[model samples]
Target: MNIYIIIPAHNEEDCIALMLESLVNQTLLPKKVVVVNDHSTDNTQLIIDGFSSKNNWLESISIQSSKEHIPGSKVINAFYKGFETLDKNYDIICKFDADIILPKNYLESLVALFNTDSKVGIAGGLAYINKGNQWIYETIASKNHVRGPFKAYRKECFQDIGGLKASIGWDSMDVMLAQYYGWVVKTDKLLKVKHLKPTGKTYHKSSKYLQGEALYKMRSGLPLTILSALKSAISKRSFLYFKNTVLGYIKSKNKNIEPLVTVEQGKFIRKLRWEGVRKKIKI
Candidate 1:
């Protein structure tokens, strides 16, 4: 499979080299690796250039953006910038976070899954974080859902989902949208990629509200939205997270934010959410 990987980096000098090194040593090397260095005041560009010079397939581009890292829009914008630099010849397209370390066979394994299951639209390895002396699975989200840090999309599926959304919940949105379009999204529990930094660890306080906004934008009505908010609160072990999420959803509704999915699609999403809720209750 012809795979192309894009890394959206902002002031990631500390860990970018380790990430590039992992890709460079991959058993299934990507056809191209483009790192979009988004206004890094640090030595991020230097690091990318240093590696890029050695391998012709690896390259980097510099672009300007706000210093403050806004959740959904910032990274997606960078991904698109890198996306425009490549041709439409790849079999799989990956949007990788700059802080993760992949095992040598990570891409090879995921590509195998894609080749094995023709219906599979998006597939990726699970992420693990280091704590004390060991790295364990990051259980923030379900293993069934593909984490945003390591999302790899089959070409047709990528096109079918209308690329990626700029709003929050894009990672989750992509999977739901893919399922809506009759494509399977799979995750390999065996392939545990090392996450140097976990999600939302460095995000601003205001970023928390974006989660609810995302749920609303995806047309997850009050019930599912509340359920999701509560689920998020449990995951983070904070009642405030749930409260803020509900507030965020209401705020988005008041602002009359556009929904990311169609009315029909929303119906499907709601059904899916309700089914999961029922299953959990039945258990």
Candidate 2:
């Protein structure tokens, strides 16, 4: 399978080199890798230049965007900058972060999963963050979830889902929409990708409510939103996170913000969410 990767990087000089190195060393190298330097004031561009100069498959592009570290729109916008330069000849398209170091076989293993199952729409490795001495699974999301940082989507499924949303919940939104369109989201626990930075570590204060806003935009409704908020708060062990999320939801509803999904899609999402909740309860 021909694989193409687009990495949206903003002020990621500290870790971008490592990420590039991992990709260049991958056993199954991507057909092309485009690193979008999103308004970085750091030496990110220098490092990208260093790699691109030596490697034919790798290249870099620059885009001007906000430096505020807003969760969704900023990165996805940068991704599009790079996406525009590529043709639609790729079998698998990946949106990777600038702070991750994948195993040499990460892309190869992902291809294996896709080859084994025609229904699989998305496939990725688990993320592990280094603690005191050992790397442990990142607990922010379910084990079943393939996090935003290392997403690889089948080309057909990517187009079917209408591509990614320029919102805080794009990752989750894509997965749900893929399932809605009859595609399976798969995660390989054995493919451990090293996450150099913990998720949300550098998010600006303005992003506090974006998660809640994302839930509202997804039309998750009040009850499901509450449950989702609670789960996040518990996982992060912060009451403020819960309060902010709920308040954000109410704020968006009151403001009558546009939703990410249509009425029928929202109904399907709500039913799917409820089914997951019920299954968890039964467990």
Candidate 3:
């Protein structure tokens, strides 16, 4: 089956070449590889151009220029370009971040999973962050991680979900949306990809922003988003730990409560806002 690989790159001149080289070395190479240059301010375009000229195996390599200043929009814009450029006959579409090195059998494993389960909409490999850095060979969620780094989908599954969301945590969004539509989604433990850098940001802050976005989405059709997150936290003991830390606040009785406005507070407030103040009081 023919598979198309889409690599959305922005200012990745330092890492793109290595990524391209890794793709060339794939045991099961893709039918076509398209790198979307999200109006990169660096020589990323030039590098793609140089490689595309020399590699005959790399079919239909194209560069798309984006005008969107926001990173999220740039990602969606690239998907637009890919959707327009890719052949409709391909069986599968694979998405990859520009900074990862895929195992040789990565593509093969994804295809195998799709063949095994016709209902499976999306499949992803495990992500290893900074094995070369301080954290080495840490099994980063052997399964169910559903990372955006390296994943594949049946072409029909992608079409059903209407393509990438273009927002942060787009992969997870796609996974949940697919599941909501009764499509099976999973991550393979054997397939692995190595991320090159150590993340400097905090997960809690990111989670807070995601919570706010979840609230925004809940206003539409999904009333169960916050409940799902809270359920996940509680089931995993994260909420219990958090509750232990904030136990005093629960007992403190304040008749007048102020609305939250900061980023983190906004997420909490937005979640509560969606649930309504009256519903919050009942809890």
Candidate 4:
């Protein structure tokens, strides 16, 4: 299967070289890679250019965007910049972060899983974040969730979800949308990748409300949104986050922002969330 990768990098000078080297050594090398240098003021472009000189499949594009590390939207926008340069003829498409190191067999194992299950739409590995000299599971999210940093999607699944949302919950949104389209989402525990930096670290503080805004935009409704907000707060052990999320949701509602999914799709999302809540209750 032909695989193509897009990495959206912003001020990632320190880790880009290591990430590229890991990819270069992949047992199943990607056919093409485009790293969108999203307004990076660092030496990120230099590292990418150095790699591009050695690897034919590797390339880079530079874009000038806001200096603030706004997260989701910026990353997705950068992905699109790189996406426009590539052909649409690929079996698998990956959106990788700039500060990650994959195992040599990472891509190889993922391709094997895709080959095994024809219905599998989205698949990737667990993310291990640095914790006291040990790389531990980033347990903030469920193991079932394929983290945004290392997401790999089957071409059909990528298109089925209308690509990715340029919002806070874009990562979660893709999985939900994939299931809505009857595609399987799987996480390979064996393919754990090294996450060089912690997530949500670079996000602008002002963007905290964006998470709640995301729930509202996804049509999560009041009940699910409330539950989501609490779970997120508890996960991070932050009451402030809980408060911010609720406020964000209301703010979005007041502004009458657009919903990310259709009415039918929203219904599916609600049902999915309800099932999850019930499962926890039963347990």
> Residue 43: error of model 2 in Å?
1.1
RMSD of each: 1.0, 0.9, 9.3, 0.9
lDDT of each: 0.92, 0.94, 0.62, 0.92
Cα deviation in Å at residue 270, candidate 1?
0.9
In candidate 1, how many clashes are counted? 0
List candidate 4 segments past 4 Å from native.
none
Model 3, 16-48: lDDT tens digits are 888887788878878888887776789888888
lDDT of 1 by residue, 170-215 (tens): 9988899999999998888889999999788878766878988999
The sequence of per-residue lDDT tens digits that candidate 4 reaches over residues 168-189 is 7999999999999999998888
What is the overall TM-score of model 2 with all chains considered together? 0.98
Q: Please give the lDDT score for candidate 3.
A: 0.62
lDDT of 2 by residue, 135-232 (tens): 99998888899999999999999999999999999999999999999999999989999999998998899899999999999999999999999998
- Candidate 2 segments exceeding 4 Å error: none
Judged by lDDT against the true structure, how good is candidate 4?
A: 0.92
Estimate TM-scores for all models: 0.98, 0.98, 0.68, 0.98
